[model samples]
Target: MSPQQKALILPEKQGNFKVGSRSIPSPGIGQLLVKVHSAALNPVDYKIQDDGIFVTHYPAVLGVDIAGIVEELGEGVENFRKGDKVLAHGNPSIIDQGAFQQYSLTVATSTAKIPSSQSFDSAATVPQGLDTAIAGLYGKHLGAGIAPPWAKTASDLEPKYPIVILGGSSSVGSYTIQLARLSGFYPIITTASPNNEDLVKDYGATHFFDRHLSGRQLMAAISEVTDSPIRIVYDAISLPETQSVGWGLLAQNGILVLTLPPSVKEDEGKGRKAVSTIGSPHVPYDEEIFRSSWAMIEKWLSEGTIQPNNYEILPNGLEGIIGGLERMRMEQVSGTKLVAHPQETK
Candidate 1:
């Protein structure tokens, strides 16, 4: 094996990405060195390049969703063995662990083995998006505080409650929909482009509305579906307009969880609240919660409880990621994740 690996490197803050060489890193205790077979693109990757957010160093490597084989396991890492297929949530804050490279080191707690039924491309689409959903739904201080469905003591009785998910066609939104269903949230409602209505529905959204629907129109449409209080609204888009819509639909005391910063003004003394979520498990407070959720991923995928986002493989390997991220920035990627194969970089 080459001592160095090809990586798509951002040479400076707000700089362009280029295929460059980087040293392969070894795993630390409680971590694993993974051969990244497939990497999925996200909006945050472009946002980092354009806005220079999250990363403090020059030549930053950015990407968060990865699926591959475990090449080496660090001390105390008992869950995965070398050569086992796995999917992990990449931590872009650390250069050696970023997903834009052919190999990366990942914390064992945030990594899960891929079930035999899923492919690397499919599993690559799950980590960041699914973790965001988990964080927003279950992170005690960061989320809506719903009980996780995978808990052994969890009640299987279906709760006849309503949950609204904004931007259901997005990678995170789609995962949010599936987790909502698993928690027995009744009449799972979401918004998406009319053409992709079926896609969100297939992910367990009980009802889908056109994304262009006005807040008033969406409220009326959703009201007809169920009069149950809309206690949780997960806004995957979290744009100003979407946040306003979600805030408007939320019942008193309900939480409006946003993937981005809260945009709408809160009503005084209304008891409704808007909270933004930090998706990565590396957050000090969030690791334990995400670790528990990550433990369930393999079973979730194996049983078809959580389906991965539809994906398109971008050409040119790691170099192709630049165009993919650009398309995401332009909002051209709808309802599907764009994936790249780092090993194919030339």
Candidate 2:
């Protein structure tokens, strides 16, 4: 029999989560077998369990943010070696790659070494959020088609262009704010509860507004921050209300990027556009940008160019994830990622 490991499994579509066992998978080419130390929860995790939107297989494991130590490396994987601490965005569609397990396989191209400045729990909060930000900002097909800051011609471009991010305190929103700063977008405007004002500012938001404001009210408020046109509005929350606000704030010929499907209709006469972005590196359209950004993860974290989201560690390890997901569904968690230790599961 192959080696077995503990996993949090969903037995059927929209099924309840339960602790179960699965065999540890071997590292295939260009992959690493990791002993998962921390797995961070996202809104999508509960959505999958509730709506069964992504996974097709039964007895599925679902989680995407992972930070762990590499137990073994597959052929053609040269950048990482055994025992290297790393963080990766897991693919919940694949059972072997799901993060809600004691051990999982990670794609080498999408994995990055975790810098000493970060702990496993903190690092686990980054992969999915950061990838979503990268895809929404830099992906031509999946996002606003903005030029990446790392590109050679990026320095020659104009700066001080204003951008707005709805839900600045969200994991995706927080990373989007940081990357927008690096891309030289000025007067970085964001919306969040007033309590998270300082937190979003630390992430590089130049202007913060109360998220409860209506679309017209938000537009009026943002006008005070910058007279420049708002060419890009990233609705990290992407709820119908937030999308309405983002669409209202976007200037003619501007783009509205959404993590969820757009609720606002685009008008060709106005030349306004709406794009939905999927953050997975495995997606062919987003693969290039994800690889480019993942390459810089270590340096960015080490230099503090990118800061991990605030995280709350869940108790009782993997079993604790159930309550955490429920809290997320109830809108109880705010401005923080929920992390679980799979190895601590009993």
Best by TM-score: 2
lDDT of 2 by residue, 1-346 (tens): 2499999998899999999888999999999999999999999999999888989988789999999999999999999989899999899998999999999999999999999999999999999999999999999998988788877383568767999999999999999999999998998999999999999999999999999999999889988888999999999999998888888888999999999987788863289999999989977896788888899999999999999999999999899999999999999988999999999999
Candidate 1, superposed: residue stretches over 4 Å from native: 152-158, 267-269
Q: With candidate 2 superimposed using the best TM-score fit, by how many Å does residue 261's alpha carbon deviate from the native? A: 0.8
TM per candidate = 0.97, 0.98
| lDDT over C-alpha atoms for residue 179 of model 1 | 89
Task: Please identify model 2 stretches exceeding 4 Å from their true place.
Answer: 154-156
Which residue pairs collide, candidate 2? none
Output the TM-score of candidate 2: 0.98
